[model samples]
Target chain A: MIITKKSYTFEVSPQSVDFNCQITLSSLTDLLLTAAQYNAEENGFGLRKLNNNGLSWVLLRLALEIDYFPLQYETVYIETWIEGVGRASTTRNFCIRNKEMQIIGYAASTWAMIDHQTRRAQDLFTLDNIGDFASEETVPIDKPIKLSERRGVLTDVFSAKYSHIDINRHVNTMRYVEWISNGFSPEHYSRKSVKRFDVNFMSEILFGEEVKVYKTEEAGDTYLFEILHNDKPSCRARLIFRSEK
Target chain B: MIITKKSYTFEVSPQSVDFNCQITLSSLTDLLLTAAQYNAEENGFGLRKLNNNGLSWVLLRLALEIDYFPLQYETVYIETWIEGVGRASTTRNFCIRNKEMQIIGYAASTWAMIDHQTRRAQDLFTLDNIGDFASEETVPIDKPIKLSERRGVLTDVFSAKYSHIDINRHVNTMRYVEWISNGFSPEHYSRKSVKRFDVNFMSEILFGEEVKVYKTEEAGDTYLFEILHNDKPSCRARLIFRSEK
Candidate 1:
């Protein structure tokens, strides 16, 4: 039987750290996404193989919670596995641990496979034996929520450029996370660390396309974001923070 | 004697690739910077150790020339070593090769050690025996040129957010590199591939600070860039591209 669960180890390099010498959220997300891709490839159902079949995977939603962010040069491991697979989507869960094997964070994400030409969802279960790898286990956290559509205060406006597009020919998922994460200030980070983050990608932002990021404070500690491409919604997210001081 | 030269291998992951499935320049620069930090730490002058003394390393100028960019999932190696160390700056060089060990690219960079508190350049020789690692060698490519000041066309404007700042409490070098690289559209990349890139960081841009990027096309294929932070020149760069068609 093919191994469904896979683990990858990584060191928090200097390039991943932020002003506090701790790993930035975007880099952490990168690590998680990397682990997901690696595990999918190990199972022989990765993006490369799917691309050959004229199909592509798109992230639908993601949620992450960290106990404490790791510092620069610290080694960490990420173990990920498919929790469940349905006709339209699949759930992948991750466990993040420090060098000592102590759990530090967890993440859960949902993905959908789509037809490359139609840009429409394809039945994910149709992939031969992809369901065989489902472990039916989940991380110790709330599932990624489906964020509501919001048209908040326009905070940032820009165009997707060459640097923004990824292998799938659209803006990378991590760049969307970055745009949402950037809505807050350094002071907010110093005073509070993200306890939970939920993001939903609705559409793809393409190269040379204009983008507008809207931000709204829904509560004392919860913030919501909507990213619009050419005035059309592309992604939405919510971040929950806990006071550190 | 401790080994001064070091090499690290990396598999180009999905997160690092662009629309063409080839590694992006920013990600490539990240790999080079990662190698520099790893080698420095291996030699006992790493940032973690420097942080204890309120000191840190900063890139001053860098120039990279790639024969062909590696594609996603391709294994590549980067070997780096200190070319020389002076009072205020040090020269480091890199060689990039594919899995078959064929040389594909070369990069040369200049860096300085600065007191984190005062933010002033320090005599690099003051570090214990750091000069011992200087190989006094040079790469085959042209050195990172010292670009002259230019008031070109304003290309991009944005505020440096928390995500832009690195462990040094200011905007990170790679972020600045991305901004400069983002100035050109995808059509430009589709037609031309970078032959050489040179960047000089003149001043630091802190969080919440607004920045403006300017571009000037000189005679031939050379393009010059000037990055201003709140109307003050912060960085400058030159990119030379070769027609791929």
Candidate 2:
């Protein structure tokens, strides 16, 4: 039997939770990506197979809408499936549920297959029946959108260290999320919870490169962030928060 | 039968590994801590129970001696048990085994029970029969020792951010390990793998506190690290790496 979609269960460990006792955005993102990996592997197009062919999947854009953040030791079930496949990119969607099977969040991600050596995007159609896995499913939220460049106040500046680099020799995606999460103070997090998060990866940040994080407060509890390396924007993200009350 | 020791298995995930595809020290530390939590809970002395009494366990010192780092997707079994319980602190030890059931590493950790409100250490003897759970087991490596003050070149300086803080409102121990790991570059990591790691938490680093990390190269593949906040040492660590021949 061919499986087009899959669900994975994860328990929120003590370390993954924040001061509020809820799971942090970065750790949630990790679970989502882990689900994607598992589903992809089960369908036979995972990173291990792609790496053997000198190719790998790279995330381009991601947007998550979460209604409730699961607390520490809570179990979350993430269901993921490929939504569509195009020549240039592919889409994946997720549905997150709590222990009671209540749907609590939705996420959408875009990815592209790239030649590891050339760093060029590969045609999705070239793979053997890769499109067969697309379920044509859609999430309730809008697709991840590109953010326009806006100058913001510098929030942080630091050089990429060894810990930031991943197996791909580039900065890990979770590290970027962590930096964005750090832009807000603990007091801000205490009063507000993240409702929506959208991020777009523009370029790769290599090791030893200095990174500057900028933040601009948008209207209505929205904040924009841009990560720059050598004056080039490497990633941009937007976070929307809702008051706890 | 009452269980005095517990064994937990963890599969190294994609996101928890470094550029070498091996599990990172921070992630390994997380698993050990997780094991500790599980064992404590089963024995009726876990954080959940302690939190109900306005108290929690705080890590004081840890030492890990690893013969190999498990790669991504590799399964590792960690057996943990309480070694002894003193009036002020408790000792816990761990044995790490790979898939073949061969011992790959050992770790020892010291922890103290502290009142959440006063942030003062409490008497371990106060807990009902907490000392009965000690198995008196021992690991081969030396116990976690107190690192002396060493002055070295400043490697990194930054303020504790929101992401660095944990549920206790202090910088997470994993972040401290990361900062110490970041003291070296990719080239250094490519040439050497950590053989032993020892860390001492002298004080807490609260959110927004400026932190300065210093690294001193010692004799024979040894490096010492010190983290300071406002000219006061908050943490000290030692790393010994072996050439990957």
DockQ of each: 0.84, 0.89
User: What's the CA error at residue A114 for candidate 2, in Å?
Assistant: 1.2
Candidate whose lDDT is highest: 2
Best by TM-score: 2
> Evaluated with DockQ, which candidate comes out highest?
2
Runs off by more than 4 Å, candidate 1 = A1-3, B1-3
What tens-digit string does per-residue lDDT give for candidate 2 at B157-231? 999999999888999999999999999888888789999999999888999899999999989899999999877
Error of 2 at B114 (Å): 0.9
Tens digit per residue, CA lDDT, model 1, B93-183: 9999998999999999999999998999999988999888888889999999999899799988889988889888899888888898888
Q: lDDT at B95 for candidate 2?
A: 97
Candidate 1 per-residue lDDT, tens place, A29-70, comes to 999999999888888899989999999999999999998889
lDDT of 2 at A122: 98
